[model samples]
Target: MLTDTVEIDQFIRPAEIEAILDQAAAAPDSAIEAILDKAARFEGLSHLEVANLLKMDDRHLPRLYQVARSIKEAIYGNRIVMFAPLYVSDYCVNRCAYCAYNECHSFKRRQLTQDEVRDEIVEIVSMGHKRIALEAGEDDVNCPIDYILDCLRTIYQTQADLSGEIRRVNVNIAATTVENYSKLKEVGIGTYILFQETYHQPTYERFHLAGPKRDYWYHTTAFDRAMTAGIDDVGAGVLFGLHDPLFEALAMVIHNEHLERTYGVGFHTISVPRIRPAEGVDLSAVYPNIPDDETFKKIVAVLRLAVPYTGIIISTRETAAMRKDLLDCGVTQMSACSAVGVGGYMAEKRRRETGEIDPTLTAQFAKNDERTADEIIAWLMSEGLVPSWCTACYRSGRTGDRFMALAKSGQIKNVCHPNALMTLSEYLEDYASPEVKAVGYALVDRELEKVPKSQHREQARRNVEAIRSGKTRDLYL
Candidate 1:
């Protein structure tokens, strides 16, 4: 058994979590319903309450899913915020056992030059993505903080077809000092996303055999530093299948609670990424705790109930059917038509146009949802859902506890709904295919009526009309 680590105790008490899990396993139907009632109120749940819901059996899962959907609708409505990943580099010094970028891998490593970064952003913009999560492997020598800032400058400055550009760039890189985070904030990043990989200290130390990432305490405390450095919006998550899923889920709740206690706000978003097969890793041997489809859905639902106000993100790692199912279970954000490798967008476009695969282009992980962005947007519209590209809150100064206060008070919809429609209209006019554009226009027209009439609504209407008439672009409330 691994010895008790101070880091673990400082964040989460394993024995307390375990004891709550045991109690939850034996919770009666009335007790479970009481917990669901609490979730419905959007008041947020305690760690013990979350553990009980996680311990629920399949018999109670249907109710749990229903409550989750209701809570999601109450908070975020039908708008699904869309983004794509832009991997600028694959260089690494870490020897993580479950990643292809592990230092022990024999594959060729590559980092994009400023020109290559511009090209990638162009392709991404042409696909109608206003938001991107810039990803990179850890390597101070190759991908230092300065390189990251330069890439950010390149992305924000490079204009795509018809003056389209990346409006938000959330970064997913290795943890560094508060000074580095402040630098990223100065460059105008949307969110500082860093996955803990796993919250279990022993499991974290085991997977990260060699590198700066091997220090569990340093990695776990990264959010505190970022928040202190004045980056209000931070995203946290764990790679499921690394350890017991229940333990990881409970630990996530503990983490969010800690952030709320210390920083006055928790995670702005919580990403749920399950481990998948990679070049250097044996999926089955290294990650034996992978959850089945039902189990995974339950986890997402529980997370929704546990943190009703925080945004939940579902990535392209899941299948189309699974992603669709999860949307109702409180997933407010999603990555559509994502490419997970360095220079992956260019490579994928080339492969689609010509039937040749680029041997030099390596993917960080294989994608399960391979639909194009247009297809995903069209499908979402057909289902009465709005595929939103809105970044108004971040730009308009509604971040951190301010945003949370509005979200909790149910007033954000007035702003979010109108902005979502305006951005959707802009997408239809600029980047969408004919078929998608037709469906999207109809959806936008119908959704316009739903936006409550006010000064902002009138402005959004004018912006939508301007976009339709080719007078403006990238307009949001």
Candidate 2:
């Protein structure tokens, strides 16, 4: 068993973080441009260099964004991987002030049964999403490790009558023991995500009035135990509005660095989520650090430069305009048709059909981009972005350091790009409106030519033909 008494100071080191930010605030233009040049060469920046980029003037923000885009294209090409969130239970024992599902709220509590999970899975699969991020609030007794394991089993086995099924299930529940994580790994889970909420200990403690989450060290180091338990692919994040965005950003990078030094790999994915006011939660003490749109873009751009190989995620919390702009700034992953409450997908479908809102339904936080899967898919195709439903890496035994190596050496695109187009083909054939199908097929034709005429591309063509003919599905390199 890993002890919570491990030295947290060695990893986070707030004093050192402040000192680095202090020096970066005065960095000259020559130094900043040189750092940008290094980042453009695919040499990731240090924590101090990332901080300096954050302090750059608004006049130079355009160059920063340009370098970010160049690096993204260099690594992953013009594809955007898509997934959706599934909230199973909202019953909580934590008093997290920013969450609508915090225990202090007055709404009725709910936990989905295994049958209900199947219902949700059918809804998600029908929307043509192959990846699912399973979410739940922190309540051990009502939502224990056994219950979560059961939910995972149900999600994997459940198939939509529309001839669809979820291909990946990424679990994002609270911190737990290594034993529980091993159980999750046994069930073939992908990416164990738990956010640090706020790395500033005082703010974190103040906001989390009561609960197991109030333990600063334990929550901050969950990934350490996760990796030790052999869950190689893990995701990390901070609630950006909980503290100074720059500080949180630096700490997050440092945490990743620590993982690289301790284990052989770092965070496989990084999420950037901002706080929004919830319907029944208090936010009296959370103030002054909310990043404006321009500032948020800067954070994303610098993060892209600092962690050139890591996947950056921008959730549906951002507006459509902001999400569109962020695609150019460095966001590689996005959530479509997301619902942050228990059974939100099916409930939403009914609401759209009958114009009836369920009074009992509540969300963790409201989503900013509320478009359906087809609408968002059409918009992505119109913008020349290939909406990918690819889970090739997870299924092909290429994750953690192995995946990172392929990505860094520029060989990942050999398989990833082709897999992306084939999956897009799958979506069009399975569940797309006439308008969406027209847009998607044209994009696929244009994109297929961009794939160099290798066996990968040829196989992609054959697999796509197989999918369209309804002979074989779920094909990849």
Candidate 3:
């Protein structure tokens, strides 16, 4: 097991961050323009530069959004990778103020049995999803690491009624030792995702009233242990509304830079989850640093310019219109048909069938977008976007620094765009509803033409045909 050698203070110096933001807040218009001009090069911005962008005047925000959109297009093109969250357990030992699963709240706590996990997997696969983020709260007794591994094994082994299977399972569990992370890596997990909740130490301490999660240093240094354990791709994020949005944004850049400097690759994905009201948490009582719609857009745009190659994820916490608006600014990945509660998907399915909402099942937080997976996929197609379910890079060994190198050099599209079309073809043929299938297939046909290489284009067309004809599946470049 790897020893803890990383100093959290080195990476997260709150005083330095405050100083930088203070300097940025006083910058003249010419200084802001120079920073923006530098950002246009696609070579990520420094923390100071990011701070300046965050403090720019409202009138200059539109130009910032435009640049972010251009950079996103240049790097990712029109493809948006899609996935869903499968909450395995809601049992927790933490008294976090922001979550409904906090020990203080009186709810029917539950963890899925192996059989129940299999049932959930069937429902998830039926929704035409190839990737899922497995979530659980930090509870050693009720939801141990062994239980998590068992759930991963079950989900990976179980096949749906229609032959649908989960191709990638990204884990979002509590911070643990390097030994546990190594075990997770051995199980072939995709990304080790853990949201810092908030990088501000005071805010973090205030919210995490109890449990191991309250240790700010240990939680902050999780990626170091993960990387040392040979888990190459780690995802990082902060709960946006927990602190000053600008401070959190600057801290995110610093965090990414620290990882890149140490591990040779930064975050594989950055999730932007804004806080929302839950069963126990009252919005009026808590002082969440919720940015206005326009300011929120600017935050996403600045993050895009700060880390051009990294994937920025926007979850269902944002409204459909907000999600749509931010998509062009920087978001390259999103969750669809998500259920934040333990056993929520199966309960939701049962409710749909019987017209009875299950009172026992409780959500972690409320979602703003309530569309089904097929509905979201169809919407993406209508907007001229490719809703991708491709997991080729992880399975093909193009991860960590290797994936970043391909993305930075503009070569990933040659593989990713075609792979997206192939995966969407599979979704349409195997699991889409009639209306969604029609839209998805039409979108695939048009997108396949945009592939740069004629050989790849022809092969993709043939692969789609093979998938449709029941000859093959999971074909990718």
Off by over 4 Å in 3: 5-9, 161-163
Model 3 worst lDDT run, 10 consecutive residues: 1-10
Q: Count residue pairs with overlapping backbones in model 2.
A: 0
Encode model 2's per-residue lDDT on 342-446: one tens digit a residue. Answer: 988879879989998888999888779988889999998888899998999999989999998888888898899889998898899989998888888888888
- Candidate 2, position 242, lDDT: 81
lDDT (0 to 1) per candidate: 0.88, 0.88, 0.89
- C-alpha RMSD values across all candidates: 3.0, 1.4, 1.4
2 or 3, greater by lDDT: 3
For every model shown, what is its TM-score relative to the native structure? 0.96, 0.97, 0.97
Question: What's the residue-level lDDT of 109 in candidate 1?
Answer: 86
Candidate 1 lDDT, tens digit per residue, 296-332? 8899999999999899998999999989999977798
Global CA lDDT of candidate 2, please? 0.88
Error of 3 at 151 (Å): 0.9
The best candidate by lDDT is 3
lDDT of 3 by residue, 258-327 (tens): 8898889999999988889899898876765888888788899999999999899988998899999989
